[model samples]
Target: MRPFHYDKPATATDAVTNFRPGAQYFAGGTTMVDLMKLDVMKPARLIDISGLEKGRYDFIKWSGKSLRIGALTPMTKLADDDKVRARVPMLSDALWLAASPQIRNMARIGGNVLQRTRCPYFRDTSYEQCNKRKPGSGCAALDGGVTRHHAVLGTSDKCIATYPGDFAQALVALDAVVEILGEDGPRSLRFADLHVLPEARPDRETTLAPSDLIIAFSIEDADFPRSKYLKIRDRESYAYALASTASALRMDGNTIADVRLGLGGVATTPWRAREAEAALRGGPATEAQFARAADIAFAGASTTDENAFKVELGKRTMVRSLLETARMEG
Candidate 1:
């Protein structure tokens, strides 16, 4: 890792002001430290904001119709919270199914959403061609590189790196709002807008400004007792998803009253399947309807030779998640 200055700011304002062009916020350090060791990220400075005002960004509260989660809250804390597990099962399940116990204990919600892709070419400096690692150089994953673990949805010719996070999928499906602190003070934006597609500029992964720091996420409480996060991978544990789905359902008798769907592991970014949710709303809660919704979700998906199976796998995953959610006892 490259040598860099470190600072621990006690206040959010100070943390935002300390942000420089080549400075990175050091929170959980699970993702940042790994990339730094790989030489994939070489920030000039590291600003530690984990010690910021505790009351402001380290607590979780549920009031009225919304659940507010501080960014600095550890993944394990959120996953184990009774309120989170009972009210937002998908959110809790996503966190629990993520990295091992030690990682969840150290990883924070803020950094988890901003975690970078696990594309081998991007992580291995030996590979000279990686658009996400070095823009304008080219993407090695598109040319003979292993793509079975890459993305099929929202992929561009410039990059096919798969998003490798679980919690972000729950946030997107629940229509959570992200709170950010920057040089200009604080601002809020839809969680769905946090990540950008790997368009022509694959290096630019998110819409966040260099000076912006994610502060918290707000998700509205709803009747989503029948919710689940289903992930499929090569192994049973400690492996990234090949295809995953977050499904929440509200049923009125046998008909679907409302639904929320978010997809991961097969997309370039946290994908909210709004079209699929629209198709399932007010429809019969059955396997056929779920399959149709799944088909609608991946209608625009583009695939490569090795990862073409992901399209079918992703569809099946979605259908299975929906069916499983439907069977849940409220």
Candidate 2:
């Protein structure tokens, strides 16, 4: 691993105060540490926020509309928690789908949601031409490219990196909000807005500033009756998805009254398939209807030679999620 300075702060303010000069705030040390070890991230300093008071971590307040979660809360804790499992089974399943039981025990909810891109070229820094790793340096993936797992949505000529986390997919589907604590103050933003698309600047990954720490994510309670996580990968377990869907539906007397659909592994970030959702909002959840929505979802997909099959794969995966959820309701 690359050599770096490490600091542990007792409070949020203390952490913010110490942030700057190309430092990265460490929570679970899962992704960031891995990147540092791989030399993908070479920060001047590492501010360890795990030392912050554990009492500050909470998931209790169901005040009016939203549910608040603490940043330091473990993914396993959240997964096994009765409240989360009962309310958001889709989110629960996504968490359960990640890593192993051991890793999930150590990984924080905040870190999982704030994880980095999984581009092979970016991770292997020996290439010396990653736009994300070294800004303005040409991207090797663009020239020596076989972009089977590269980004499809929100990509640019500069980069086509894929966001490689499962929890963010659930967050986008639920229309969740991520809380960021910075040197200035705390702020809230929609999860969809948190991740930056590589439209122009492929170097930027998120809306977070240098000093900001992801505090937690909040999801408003929606009365959508059924939700499901359908992830298709090369294996049965402990693998990242090639095409996945996080879908929720509310049925009104044999028709779809409402729907929430999010795509994973098929794009740059947690992509909300609003066009597909809008088409099937009040339509019957029949085979043709589900297929039609899947078509709409994949309509705007801009894929290349390597991953063109993802368009069809994404549609089939979405349709399967809908059909399976509909059967479960019956």
Candidate 3:
């Protein structure tokens, strides 16, 4: 990594003051350090924001009604929290489905959301043609690639990179909110609205400005009659998702009262299948209804050559997730 000054701030004000034109915050240093070593993140100064009392990973605030997780909270802490497991179990399971134990130990909850993409050409500049890594350089994945893992929901001619994270998927499903601190003061955003699709500019991924710092995340909880996260990857452990779905259902007798869903591994962002949710709402919870609902979610998707598999896989995965969440009592 290039030479950089280090500052450790104890307060949000201190952290904001330390932000300069070309500086980056250092939290767990798992993803940041990896990119720094690769020369992709060459910040002139590094502000260490790992330790703060109000900033610690605080899962104890979680009840069945509300949940708040601190920014500096380690992924390990979240994956092990009993409350997270019970209320939003899908969120906890997504953390467990990420990297590995050791990596998770060093990865922070906030940093995980801000981590860069897994696009090969972007990660290694030797390709010299990833528009997202360096705009106007052009996208290699667009013309010369087998983009099996690329996006089917959100894509542009410039970049079709997938948002490769698990936690955000469940966050979208539960309608979570993210807490960010900035010079303008703290503000909250619906987690589903945080990420931007590749409609116009594929270069940018989120709404966060340069000087903003994430503090915590809150998810409102209801006794969603049932919910589940179903992930399909090449392997069971230590692998990125090929397709995944998060679904929560409220059932009344043999009918569906309400439905919530968010999809991953097939879109440019946390793909919220709102249409699917609508289709299932006030309808039966049978396999056919679930399948139809899943179909509605992707009716507007535009597929590419290699990632067309995602559409079918996504539909099937959505069905399985719904079935598990609905419990489908006989």
The best candidate by lDDT is 1
Instruction: Give the lDDT ranking, best first.
Output: 1, 2, 3
> Per-residue lDDT for 43 in model 3?
90
Tell me, what's the RMSD of every candidate? 1.0, 1.7, 2.0
Task: List where candidate 3 sits over 4 angstroms from the true fold.
Answer: 54-57, 328-330
Backbone clashes for every candidate come to 0, 0, 0
Cα lDDT, all candidates? 0.91, 0.81, 0.81
Lowest lDDT sum, 10 consecutive residues, model 3, at: 53-62
Error of 2 at 123 (Å): 0.6
How do the residues 1-330 of candidate 3 rate in per-residue lDDT, one tens digit apiece? 789898887787788866898888877898889888888778988888887556554444757588778888889888898766776677777889888899899888898887777877778868777877677888888878668878788777778888888878888888889999988999999888788876556667889888898888987773443666788898998887888998887778878887889898888898888877877888888999988988898787677777888889988998998888777331
Give the TM-scores of the predictions, in the order they appear. Answer: 0.98, 0.95, 0.94
Q: What lDDT would candidate 3 get against the real structure?
A: 0.81
Mind giving the per-residue lDDT tens digits that candidate 1 earns over 168-271? 99999999999999888899999999899988899999989998999999987644678999999999899999999999988899999989999999999999
Indicate the residue-level lDDT of 255 in model 3.
85
Q: How close is candidate 2 to the true structure, as a TM-score?
A: 0.95
- In candidate 1, which residue pairs get closer than 3 Å at backbone N, Cα or C atoms, i.e. clash? none
